[model samples]
Target chain A: MKAIVPIKRVVDPYAKVKPTADGAGLDSGGAKFEINPFDEIAVEEAVRQKEAGRFTEVVVVSVGKGECEEQLRKALAIGADRAVLLETQEPLDSPAVAKVLSEFVAAEAPHVVLMGKQATDDDNNQAGQMLAAILDWPQATFAAKTDFAADKATVVRETDSGEETLELPYPCLVTTDLRLNEPRYIALPGIIKARSKPLEKRPLASVPAPKSSVVSFAPAPARPPGRKVGSVAELAQAIKDRGVF
Target chain B: MSLLVICFDPSELSQVAGFGASFGTYDVLLLTGEAGNAGASKIHVANLVEVPPADNIGKSVASVAANYTHVAAVSSMRAKDLMARVAGINQSAMITDVVKVFSETEFERPMVAGSVLARVKAESTPIVMTFRPAGFDKTVPGPNGSVESISISDTGRVKRVSTSARQGGRPDLSQAKFVVSGGRPLKDAATFEQVIGGFADKFGAAVGATRAAVDSGIAPNDLQVGQTGKVVAPDLYIAAGISGSTQHMAGIKDSKLIVAINKDGDAPIFDQADLGIVGDLYEVLPELEKALS
Candidate 1:
């Protein structure tokens, strides 16, 4: 069995971002780029599953410009067997990205597709579900723990209510959550070995145009500065003043 | 344009109804539980008493989504999952965590956490979206809408083994009018609940925790309030012992009034706070609880 993981390149999670002057999109504020933190967790989970002998091979896939190959290589260093990059310059929204991934999944026919629940950039939390829908496959999202049998996978998902356990048959999709596992730091030797891994780059196949686009972006409204109170009674009065008490 | 508002949580029906009513005459797909007066023209309910897994319900929604120009739900983990599938099956446009609706084709949502609000336009039909209920007004209870039974097939491919529901009866963190959250300084689970939770009980405010607190196992994952956790916009947010990481700030930026209580007066949280108290939360929270009482 083979497991496929799709990762995304995003602004570093810790970086502060702002709207560009024209208000069309965000400025990364000179923040470094990295594999989206959630996607990295997905990569780590897929690699761990391979190590456990549940799958014979693990392949990391990414979509976008050539720069994405850097992230793909990082996934390789983290223990993915190989990497595939569908190079494209056209900006894609969730629907279009899902369409592209569904096509790839159909062709690859991996038993399981693992990915992040959401990308920190858009934070749409949709691709895996959308891909499952297009593929007509079952999906378990926000997965905190996953146990795979020969033909099925039981996943514990982190939901708003609490944990929910779902059992899904083979050829399914599971989106990783933060608590799934702690990703290992890539050592110098691992990085050196990544250079030798097969990094395949192919032209992005034709897909439908994005159905939705960002029209403009504006900075979030700022909160008024606050004053410090001297005592607990004063704090209680402040809370009372807000009508919250 | 006609709208079909999907709701799985009966408790949020009024908020969902209020949002849908803003777009015009709307119908509802009540997936589970009981709903009170929601003001929807039609309340289409499924057979189940409890909400089914997302994939099962998603197929049911996709099967019927084409009948309306807009399909929406109050944003939640499960709803977002199902709606994405609906969007995929229909090959339609979708926007999640939407904060504003300009028309059937236009909407506003936050990205990069809540630091930026992006106005988005849907160039396709049956715009599938999830609205942040916190940003909208709850509709006043009206007469119960007409009910219609909707058939939902259990795909059986995905089986729900169980659900460990969170401690109930407290207002949901996302919908609470006031929130009291703590960070790692609160320490272990017992102390977290006793201090932060105790203080919150004074005002009926929901208790929240920073990711560090959740990661350290001091708090439950559901109580995590940050970029990757639950977003809150309460009228008053008291953040205790939190230095305010950027991700945590992103989640609470929408809050109406922020108050920070920490020993470190220069903590980043104070930069965003509307009021602050530079003191130990262990000492301050107990005193504040007493004062509020």
Candidate 2:
């Protein structure tokens, strides 16, 4: 069995992202980029599954400009057998990205496609589900725990209500949540080994262009500064004064 | 001319109807399993795509959405999952967690963990969206809307094997009026259940936890309240032992009134709390609970 993990490059979660002066998108200049935290978990899950003998290969894929190769290399270093980059400089929306992934999935027919629940940059949280829709395949989003059978995978998802477990047939898609697993760090030896691993690059022109466009962007509203109360009694009194209780 | 509001759970109809109401002078179509009373203009009872396998739900919705100018639903995990796929099938411009609706074509939503707001304009014909229920006013049940039964074919692919919900009497964290959240200081699951859970029960508040606490296994993943977890905006929020990381603060920033109790006076949560009590939670929590009781 083979697992395909789709990874994304996003502004580091710890860094502050500022809107561009033109208000069209984020300011990319001098900003640090890293593998999306959730996608790292996806890669880690695939690697763990491979180590457990559930998979013979774990292939990591990314869609973006040339800079994305750095992220794919990091995935390779993290134990992915190979890396694929669909080199596209143009920004693609979630639907367009899903379309390209569906095409790839149809051609590759991996046993399972794993990816993050959402990217921190766009925060769309749609790609994996969209991919499932395009393929008419089963999807389990926000997976916290997973178990595999001969031809089925049981996933426990973290939802607004509670944990929901679902059994899906193979050749499905699963999106990883933050709690899925702690991603393992790459050591110096792994980094050196990744240098010799296969990294395939495909032209973006092979995929469909994005249908939706971002017209503008702006900063969020700021909350008012709050003052500290002296004691719990004062806090209760303030709540009473404000008629909140 | 018409707005289709897909209803997965009957209980969420009012919220979905409320979101649909934002499109003034539009018809509301409730697509659900069992046809019940709603405030919408019309109701469609469909059974073929009633449960999980979000793909089937998306297809069912897409079939009806083709006739409407706008499509909306309550931004629950289920709805977002299904509608996102519907958006992909229709190739429509879609947005989720929309906080405000300016019109049928324009809306506002938070981005980058609520630090930036983006006003979006949907150029597509049937603009698809999922509105955060907390962001909208609850819709009052008006004259019983018209009901129509629609047939749907099952795309049997995904199956729900089992569900293990947290056995708790507390209200759901996202929809609770009051939320009592804990942080890393809770130490262990036992302490978290004893202190945080105990206090939450006393106040009839839902239990929430910081990412740190959840990561430490002091709380379950669903109880995590942060940018990466559940975004909650309860009327009253109490923070115990939390130092309020930016991501955590982002989730609860919309809370009507915030009360923070922490040993560290300089905790970032204090800066956002409407009332801050600098003290050890071990002592303060029990004392507060005693006083309230």
TM-score, first chain, each model: 0.97, 0.95
Docking class of 2: medium
Q: Model 1 — TM-score against the truth?
A: 0.97
Which regions of candidate 1 deviate over 4 angstroms? none
Q: Write the per-residue lDDT of candidate 2 for residues B3-112, one digit (tens) a residue.
A: 77777666666566566667754444444456565676777766544455675466866887888877777766777678888887777777877888877677888777
Residue range B156-178, candidate 1, lDDT tens digits: 66899999988876788988888
lDDT of 1: 0.86
Alpha carbon lDDT at A183, candidate 2: 95
Count of residue pairs whose backbone atoms collide, per candidate: 1, 1
Model 2: TM-score for chain B: 0.92
Candidate of highest TM-score? 1
Tell me each candidate's TM-score.
0.97, 0.94
Weakest ten-residue segment in model 2 chain B by summed lDDT: B24-33
Tens-digit per-residue lDDT, A1-245, candidate 2: 88999999998887777678888887646778999999999999999999999989999999889999989999999999999998887778787789888888888889899999998877778899889888878888999998877779999888776777888888888999988899997877877778999999998775565555666788776667778877667667776677666
Best by lDDT: 1
Best by DockQ: 1
